[model samples]
Target: MMEKADICHIVMYPSPGRGHLMSLVELAQSLLRRHPSLAITVLISSPPHLLPSIIPYLSSVSSATPSIAFRHLPPSPSPSLSSAPTAFSDDPAMYFEYARLNNPNLYHDLSELLSDSQPSQKPKALVVDFFYSVAAEVAAALRLPTYYFLPAGANPLAAFLYLPTLHKLTTSSFKDLDGNVDIPGVPPIPAKHMPSRMLDRSSRIYGHFLETSTRLAESAGLISNTFEALEPRALKAISEGLCVPDGRTPPVYCIGPLVAADDHISKHECLIWLDSQPSQSVLFMSFGSMGVFSSKQLREIAHALEKSGVRFLWVVRYPPPHDEMWRNLAIKPEDDPGIDEILPSGFTERTKDRGLVLKSWAPQVAVLSHDSVGGFLSHCGWNSVMEAVFAGVPMIVWPLYAEQKLNRAYLAWDLKLVLAVAESEGGFVTTDELAERVSELMLSEKGREVRGRAAEMRNEARQALSEGGSSRVAMAKLVDSFKKGMM
Candidate 1:
């Protein structure tokens, strides 16, 4: 092993979006907190609209942790790769991926910046989100150690790592599989609970996913945003190389639940609304930053909220017109008048006393941390799930896209930390079903049982992060390995 350097730095390349950027930022901050002398840089390449929110959030964290800096790269131009899929022109799922595949600017910008760095300031390792398979190639060329940061639990990671095997074992997509697909060392997840992207073998994104998962094995290690107690079985499987052939797998580190702290949480109006509600009385609903629902669906949600009769705080966004694809766009905080037009007639006025509907972004961390929030009606994004667990709040899982369906399965069926909202006939969750689910999560005995489990998990999560705990020890070992040039 090489002698420890006087200064250690890691460059993080976050995929374009709120969730990816936020989780990576949290990981950087966590490293800085644990190792005060370390320096970090977050290389961002997101859509223009999200800059307002993301910039401020990063700024706040930077102010407190001066070792961390950010570099926002220009959004890449349209598909430049000759092999780029022409069919993905309007597919929202491929929005960022398309930008990344087409634009070569990210690699150039990163390389140039690193080349310009002083010898002492040059990063020893490059940390990148899972979407950044290209960064691994860059790191290998530069001979810098690379760690793949998976902003999800080990279960999802294990499932994804085994995609090739799953593809070989079945003739059809996992969604079309007759029964549960039993992943070694992980729970038997129903085929329908797999990610929508993985459900179709022919989709461009599916191919991309498989390639990325394979590329991940080339890295020095994996930094999972999960702890041991949370998914011991999955973590064990991953560490033992059950997800992939032994010696092909990288060293797996479980150092997570790396959720961000809301710095300006005190200023959000939702906190005031939450304060007035009694403990465990309000259900908070917020799809992730990119989550969307049709106008008709929004109306149904409003009616369901009205019928549920539970004190609620709903975070709403206006989706693009019914015919238009939902792009990665932000609804400005100042331009929320259209919500009134999109919501059902008289819904706001009727529920004024019992509900508060926040437009666009809310202090999600603060909202979940609040004593008044009992249950979360979430899109089951891993970050939101982590926050809810840390706050000891159970969830009403309503997965939207990406790995959310997989998360929903783990949370609802595997871990028993949430209640799932059943979709009605024709694949839409009706107002009646929504209302029943909200009521059950808020008022039923099952809700209490789930909440108890959530609280227990919350305690376990807190313990995992404390001194001498699993996360702390894992993170310590990771830092030591990096310093010793062993990772």
Candidate 2:
């Protein structure tokens, strides 16, 4: 029994991709846990192929948490893939960007749904992913306050917020700026380590990034997927308006390290293998949903893993076109090619005793939570980083695309939670370098120190989420702000 005056309805729109969707869902769950009578409607802007995989999870969450609900936006009116960001058309992210550019459909459908709703069903505030920034105008038209939900760490948000200032100060592109050019709240990072999209002003994706950042700054508030203890300096800089000129940055609520629960524990064989291994003896490697490698890179990785002598569970997927096929249809083992087809000849046979080469996706959260797992070799996606921190696992950073390079810099150089596998000429990491780094992280005293730090961070993450903790207080403030129309 909570009072009717305490209830508030919040509409959440998550951009496409599993990481973004998962963060938003976890935030919704956390809100319901902390505040009674809070209702959430998650409006999804995912592709047709991706929806089937997510619907079951949404159904389970809805059944368990009565206050949370879901809705899918209708197809785009102009569903042409050619209208997508032209700079990186081959990248899988183009699909989401295409959906985002055509988000007038989401606005139209949401308006219709809200118009026909009862007074109780009306949303008090709208919360949206950074990609779906167009929803800010929709929220304004409906007289609802909007908050931008940044699924990445505060470092990326700070970078985005200050990018305009950096652009104005420099005569050339980001690629031409000094390697040590500093952004407020973040370490002085080289242009190579900054987000690649923001480097070239002529690129379509660059323009989109610029526009989204401006829109996010103009919103009522910001919700970041990071806890206060994890990023105190970055959070403080944003709140104090160090990045934005004129001290006009929005109020920030850091209620995160929001990770998925291990719901599919019984669904994978790797868990059984992990149960038999000694404590803290295994490594887990995964690139987030869109991470793919060429056949040459896969062979190099296989050789490196064999050379390291460390126990590992690696999730491998074929290069895209085939890699993306799972999104469109159910992935059957018989239908998809085996590891033998992709990896070097006899690679699996040689490593079968100490390694598990799982094709495509694995139950990541379940695998990370296993006692036998110690270190993660990852693409440095923010969700994966948070999950690793929560599980007390150190990392070897292997950034591939998007904002991952920045994440790698933050984790390995700034936060000291990870070791980076250095890339050779042409952005390809040498086999020897990969093997050496893996061995160091899985065996050396330096690795032990990093592991200890990770455990300490895990404790801090728990503390931030506990009762009377920083995240709990921030969440309370967020709810109050939305409810009172004070944002």
Candidate 3:
């Protein structure tokens, strides 16, 4: 697909984990797929580690492509807040530490990349990770165009970041903060629903989150991984108010839900499983890779799911120890049991027909996109929210930790498309509460309303990803920033 073009493209993302890399890879591939003539460069945090020989596919990426190139940049020898894992206690202090430790090196790396790169061609623009505000500064230093790459829809972004601004005006905090806090231009969000870390004055992570948010306010414009119908208000606000209130706020591009189902399989089996199930009869529960839960918690969840008698698809990662029966498989088979090994006995066999317990990774998108999926039990990660919205699956927001509470609030309170489970009475949810909410959300009248709304959103979201959709236009505008200097 290569054609003669003089522009060089430098794509930079955090190297802490695969999530950023995977997202960046997809975007890069999309650009390469769409514009073969364009020169592309990707700067990862570290060199690619050797892929497991047993699983062979990444070689397809490093080996097959000629025009596109991947380069690894060095991060701080010390890991930072962004790299730190969330503890089961749901604290955000660690998050601040990660960002602080990482950003210095992150900034240093971007500056170095800009200063040192000798592209056979000069970069036409600098595309950055939205979370990493330093990219814009780096581009500005060299007078290059910059674009903010947001991984979720604008609704939640506007909802979470503007909480303080809204709180100041409305004399109330939004949902998820704990109790109902009212905000300007937004519905009530609870204190419990607000990110647990945001309330922590002593949070090492919250401070870092605040720092990055400050940088986000100054980015050139937003290039979100969502389409218009998914977040109309957010897109409008971003377009008019310059999107960001505290910073140099730029335009917004909603070219997303950038979903690619064909990327991985052995996953399709899930779809076939759904095909055999009744419509809207199944519940999908998954806490993303990084979320941590105690072994007792895992066992409680296992017992709760079993007691509910609801059909479910649960993705079990390394689990916390529950009983001697669980000790045998305390962790994921690989990666040391660290903690994941405690599960109740007869988990798979007892729930065999009624449930499917998948270890490691399953294609989340494909599963959610299925028709039989009635409700989603989620951690409220931005990516999961996008998938749930796109798939029209209503959520049961678990929000295990981190910014998840805020994300959960957006879906449950602001959008009224999902139900939020509170953790205030106690820090964590027990199995009884988990099953109760699952039952309520998956079968009750309120659940029906949420499901209907979610389905409606799914339709609107799909259209946004189509030709000439608002999201498409927004994406085009962002890409055009490269072709024409920010005018």
Candidate 4:
């Protein structure tokens, strides 16, 4: 073991959700593997409802990596709201408020950790998830360098850094805009295709998002979970300072494809089923943790799947209540009802020979990496997208919420790695439309071409993580800058 005095220490603060935490943890693991003398302390601030889901993952990481430590900040009281938000579970305002309320605890915990460290082990930086940009002020008062880790690709980062400019240019909400909105790196985003939070400029969530976007420029550097080969154009635009027109863009480090480690012990039935299928014949469909559908939407999907005749493994979740008040809330895994109760009657029996419909959860990373899996019908969340990319699986982009619509735009229009599924008004996909996209992705010539591209990208992703690759070089540069105190 290395001497304590020779270690370089750092603090990482990720936002509340599982996706955000997983990204930062993977990043820490990567850093520790490269520089064994480095020490990391991850500060976790989980919402009360999400704590259970987070604990098991945290325990596993601690057991596997003793060099990395975890500290749970005492929960801050919930912010007083004027009214109950539409989707309380997935609300951005809740995340922002949690981060804001925990500022004092963050300062105390960080100061204590730093003061306790040996002289040579003073923390080189305090890295935070972009959602917690408000913490930069705390880092500043303590005289620590602050960096923002965006758990997303470069295209979303470009849009986020450019959001303040877009806000200034527009007089109305993005949803009401007459034409496409232009960010520096990516193609013009249709007004309706902008992130749901940005659609209403007057909402509290929009205000919080705009503030976070403005504050991102104050960081020492921005690190994204994407590689140079994956997003060449967007990365170039960011490097050239095109995204931030009025301010200096901080140095950007592209160190990723930071996927979660696959679970090797517990093999799911889905994996067993995939083993029996022909090579590259199964299409896997799963939404991210927050993704849910209405009963009507679920039925439509079942109809499409049964009619398509493709071998498949789908993870099904209970539909949200039709009650307007509860319609947007996420369905927890424990809350999932019987599969037969939600899907079309006899849907499971009809598709039994060709498909396996699992309830609520699956080992997503393992399934995507399986040899028999060819296509992914995904919600286009960045983490899910990266996992698919790493597995070399082409996708059918079906964006649900958060920045997913924007991600869909990038994956489909800019990268051409996935086929886009168009949604009708109020975000419903028809049976015919779903079936057609499924067939196109599984059997058509276009599917073959996209599959080839995804394969090429998978190789590039592996290469980027290897020695002498772009991501590895970027990782070295980040560590060097930290060591030299070059902000």
Better of 1 and 4 by lDDT: 4
Model 4 TM-score on a 0 to 1 scale: 0.94
Candidates in order have lDDT scores of 0.77, 0.80, 0.63, 0.85
Which residue runs does candidate 4 get wrong by more than 4 Å?
79-90, 323-336
| TM-score between model 3 and native | 0.79
Error of 3 at 334 (Å): 6.8
Tens-place lDDT digits, model 1, residues 205-239: 78878887887776788899888999888887877
lDDT of 4 at 260: 71
Model 4, residue pairs in steric clash: none
Q: Which candidate has the highest TM-score of all?
A: 4
Model 1: lowest-lDDT 10 consecutive positions: 322-331
lDDT per residue (tens digit) for residues 187-227 in model 4: 78888788888789989889988998887877888888899
RMSD of 2: 3.9
- What are the models' TM-scores? 0.88, 0.91, 0.79, 0.94
Ranking of predictions according to lDDT: 4, 2, 1, 3
Pull out the clashing pairs in model 1: none
Cα RMSDs of all predictions? 4.5, 3.9, 5.0, 3.0
Candidate 2 lDDT trough over 10 residues, lowest sum: 80-89
Lowest lDDT sum, 10 consecutive residues, model 4, at 79-88
Global lDDT of model 1: 0.77
